[model samples]
Target: MTSPSHHAPGAEHLLTRVGEVLKPALTHYLDLHAHPEVSGAEARTADRFGRRLAAAGCELTHEVGGHGVVGVLRNGDGPRVWLRAELDALPMRERTGLPYASRDDAMHACGHDLHLAAAAGAADLLARLSDRWRGTLLVVGQPAEETLTGAGAMLRDGLYERFGRPDVVLAQHAAPMPSGTVAHAADRVPMAAAGAVLDVVLHGRGGHVATPHLAVDPVVTAAAVVTRLQNVVARETAPADQVTLTVGTVRAGTAANVIPDHAVLGIAVRAAGEASLDRALAAVRRIVRAESAAAGAPREPEVTVASRSAALLCDPHTTGSVRRAHTGLLGPARVLSWPGSMATEDFPLFGDAGAAIHGERGIPLVYWMLGVADPDAWHRTTSDGITSDGAASGAPDAAPPPAPNHSPHFAPHIGSALRPAIAALTVAALDRFAVT
Candidate 1:
């Protein structure tokens, strides 16, 4: 791996420009956090991001695949480096209590708002230092990432064909770790999980609740299925194989006095490999069918696989290069090795994994986790202190753990996190771009 001292001559200028663009980047983060849109409905978010890219002198294109935005910056061609960030938010409410927190039903609970601002800041800095580097820059705002569908959607819509295939794709995600730090996977797989989302409908006969003997209740069957799903991971899956099955949503009757004709369930499964994921999915289908049969329902249960994606694996060579660049920019202490996670992502589709959609392969991808937690707040919660119950303790605060991704309380310390994130992206892209 290359050392920080061996960075190109332009690296110092890139770091200096990060401070110059911090103010507006923070303003953008605040605005995005206050107003967020959910998956497949990111018109406003896309527009805001597109305008930022345009202001940074990128030739912009909109609506590549369901509100996806693409911006191109060419400074004499060398390596085409793509910096990708998510545009859509989660379908949940924010409870961070920040003055600029989302007031609507949707929330940027996953730090996508932070990601966008950082990408925009990097775009501005890179464009300003255009003469120092030679290459094309592709800044992409992808939508529907919460549903794990946006990357595939964009690829299917000819992301590479229309905008030109990239030599490398770089992305970063916000994590609960302390601010001013970045973590890269130590293994080949950055995210070691493949997942599938399932939608199920249970059918039965409806009648008055008083005449329970005459009516079949699908709600009962749905409950049974949910209970049995736990056994799939606990008893069926190998202990070494990491797997999780969750019934996220369940809807049944309208009135308590009346039995509903059907009940619906939204199921999600994640596993370390495709075979484990397949087995878990199969088990889910079997449990649903058997429960419906046991309930003596008039019709069989319906099951549909809503979305799925393969495990995300980073290009080892590319990742090592970027990791070294990050070390050069942020110092060795701030750059850490990441233990592979079970979090699933559709980002794999942007590389060789989605050869079926893009008809191309060998596009290197580099992803790292950006720390977003406030150092003081994080230390307060993690330090040994008196327990809430008035007892002395040596353990971290247990009353309220640090809010993680997808949590209603998840909030990034923008002041400390934003600049590092921008610098991380800028250095990684600069490392790939030819030094003029």
Candidate 2:
């Protein structure tokens, strides 16, 4: 029941043929990048993938949870494997000075473009290898990864109920690390649990500049709450456990003379464990209430927490498979330890409880950091060569490449950085599914 077009000439030929196959894909992918779309608003993007996957003879389901797409390919009675790629773009203005850099309001700063291309390329490769593999292949194009809502929404909307859950789920993210390097560890926690929002509006009386104690002064209370919230991480939790409490934004009075009637406090929290997170939230509530009361505020502050993401755990079995596959193909030098990260990914919600909470079903999350930053310059500056002044490596003339991730001027070495990633993930998928 397979298409004659799916009969690829040679699986080994993919290594050499990848470039030609990817050229058109890369163009299309970059075009999508140019006109990036945000989460829940990816109708056009999802439609594009729907057509692309259908043309390749893969079964397609569109509009899953707003703008998500799933492509299914069944090959006899082999194990079911799930491969995912995020389709949404960030709200960032493009700064990468490339000919194909994003021109639209939204940008692909996180390299989801690479992820989408790799998934499609893998689909093409696996479609060709259908004769060699068994079981079902589910390639998912998920949306709203940046907003941390897409995956969770899809699951809630019956992704497993409709498509049937996979025995093994695999997803890869493009990182700003080294080009040829892959990061993996047996017990890897690629991202932590995170929550953020603007809440806790403090009410007070506005007064004239000459007023001494007429105004409640919510701004003063907010400043105190910010200082006290830090104690939650410092005093409540153990020194070793990682937790973060930050006040990113605060808004209050307009005039210096008059005391403002109201002020708003924005809070953000991150933790590695659920228990710790609960404790952190409790502490936030306690601080807001007590501080407002102390400030002699009349009414209770309205508190609300908006965005939330659970901690990401890498399944040992899958992580081990990825490590073995990566090391076997790229060698130990290129496969480095999974450098710990404070950032968070919502991918953890994919795993069911008691799945290993840390095991493959438990972790099912393997995040590899692809070294995209210039290694030569990094090595020189990091080494004990020059002072902190103008010169490191005793070479004041040397300067590092543009900053990586979140920097306005950051640029990726597309050919060197992206090609190796495609190769690594392709080989890793083949290894995981025993396709080759």
Candidate 2 per-residue lDDT over residues 189-219, each given as its tens digit:
5444545443678877778869848778898
Tell me the spans in candidate 2 whose CA falls farther than 4 Å from its real position. 1-14, 103-105, 188-198, 205-214, 251-261, 353-365, 374-398, 434-436
lDDT of each: 0.87, 0.68
Model number with the top TM-score:
1
Please give the distance, in angstroms, between residue 297's alpha carbon in candidate 2 and its true position after superposition. 2.7
Model 1 whole-model lDDT (C-alpha atoms): 0.87
Model 1: weakest 10-residue lDDT segment is 385-394
What TM-scores do the predictions have? 0.94, 0.82
Per residue, candidate 1 scores C-alpha lDDT tens digits across 341-423 of 77788888998889999998999989998888876666566456323321224364434546888999999988789988898
Screening candidate 1 with a backbone cut-off below 3 angstroms (N, C-alpha, C), the clashing residue pairs are none
